[model samples]
Target: MNDKVLIVGAGAIGGFYGGLLAKAGADVSVVCRSDYDVAKHYGYRIDSYALGNWQLMPNQVLRHVSEYQGQPDYLILCTKVTADIDRVTLIRDAVAPCTTIVLIQNGVEIERELQQAFPDNLLVSGLAFICCNRNAPGEISHLAYGKLILGNLSGRQEPKTQYLRDLFLGAGIECVISEDIVASRWQKCVWNAPFNPLSVLSGGLATQAILQNQENFVRRVMREVCSIADACGHPLPADIVENHIALTRDMPPYKTSMLLDFERGHTMETEAILGNAVRAAQRQSVDCPCLESLYVLMQLLELQIRSSSLLN
Candidate 1:
């Protein structure tokens, strides 16, 4: 196996997963934007719930993909899929034919762009079921669960998939090999579509409070997401909604990543998680009232943020 892994966007998800891979003996190189100096000097400090506390100074800290000196085995793109960034373009130069580009990003209908951009190169879709936050430079707080599901968009397992799974598993993390990554994206959207937006719209309420005070609204949004998914030809598991509810009930009272992004005055992932889902529903003529409403609200919020930024 090619033991070298390059982590682009060294923030919460990137730092946590990349730190573990480096700890597991992979030749991991991390590329950071904001925390470049800190990552270069002090390395990453990951306080994981599952893997416990760990730190890494790989000696290969890079500020951008252009600084990478090797043909990487895995170029993991852990950046947030937002309106301001063209994800495919960011990883263009370093994406060799041998590189298995692992996109551990959140969004529906996001894989096609990269797949089209690099047809010959291997693409792996990753879903991170964890509550992690990077409140400051060189620091990652992994608050809760950290299981990862990985698969190609083609709906089949490749040899590379097993290698990636084993790589994460070797790092003392629970990793599952998925069959249909397309469906998996939609499945994740069920929970993401509602809570992420409502958390921000509700004047920054935490997960527990949102569920406690607005259970019915949450359920309705989830059901709408499921319906949209089914119309798009990927029916989710029957009890996934209940599973999310129970998971949230037992989860620590914490702010979501989207909420954190808004709180920190950064761009929230409004379009990827909610906008894409709503657009897909519209194509299939499926009525996603809840999703449509949330998308509009988030767009307005994003606009407000932009206007405020201009004045400052």
Candidate 2:
């Protein structure tokens, strides 16, 4: 039988990966908000530099989770980790006993809420190392790298995790299953902690520009994150910092997801991406002056955005 997958937040990352699952013959469905009318009428248009262009017509394009017809085998959550939204409340109704909840979002220490919400169901922590964005309604542009890492949060090797990896592989994308997903989250944070906020703080600079101008500052922030990760017992690889810098230097000059959100006048994931890490550093007694400074600046920026939105 085909896997029934329901995507809760079908933006760029969700839409692109959900489309790939459809390509792998999963009965994919989406619950859209902003692009509901367009996705319901037409379908998602995926333009990938690596895999080429394609369209994904979901089995259902729903307005809310309650509107779903049946229980899905997998419920993938790809929403931004922000303070304004309640991630658990968004998908609580649709979770069944057998359903495996997968979170393909950025941030460290974000898994406990979902695990507590549905203790009986299996939860998978996912990370997407890709440069993808939503150009417009129902349109996704996959600009660069598209690798996925998924692992069970409880440290159990489940077959469903492997199946999901195979699906991405079959769709021509690289997907790996990790034994320690928390460590993977920390590793990704080593890059995200530096580039994401710096992109916005630099007044909408791309990754390349930020690296070019503030390479030293970026490395300091990354090292802070590594220290926090080590203190938390999820020590990263020795060469992770250099590896991320090299990768960023080689990739196309691209705007980060945080910068894109700031440009769109939307709420950025300041708390999730930076705030959480800073708090973790505090809990571990790790000195992260650079990371803490970035967090404060972002919080002020978010306040400014909110104030501006209120005025206009």
Top candidate, metric TM-score = 2
* All candidates: TM-score: 0.95, 0.96
Query: lDDT at 167 for candidate 1?
Result: 78
Query: Candidate 2, residues 10-68: lDDT per residue as tens digits?
Result: 99999999999999999999998998999998899999999999999999999899899
lDDT of 1 by residue, 140-229 (tens): 998877889998878778898788888789999899988888789998888888899999998899999999998999999999999988
* Candidate 1 local distance difference test against the native: 0.88
Candidate with maximal lDDT: 2
- Tell me the deviation in Å of residue 268 in model 2: 0.7
lDDT of each: 0.88, 0.92
Worst 10 residues of 2 by lDDT: 264-273
Judge candidate 1 at residue 275 and give its lDDT. Answer: 88
Q: Pairs clashing in candidate 1?
A: none
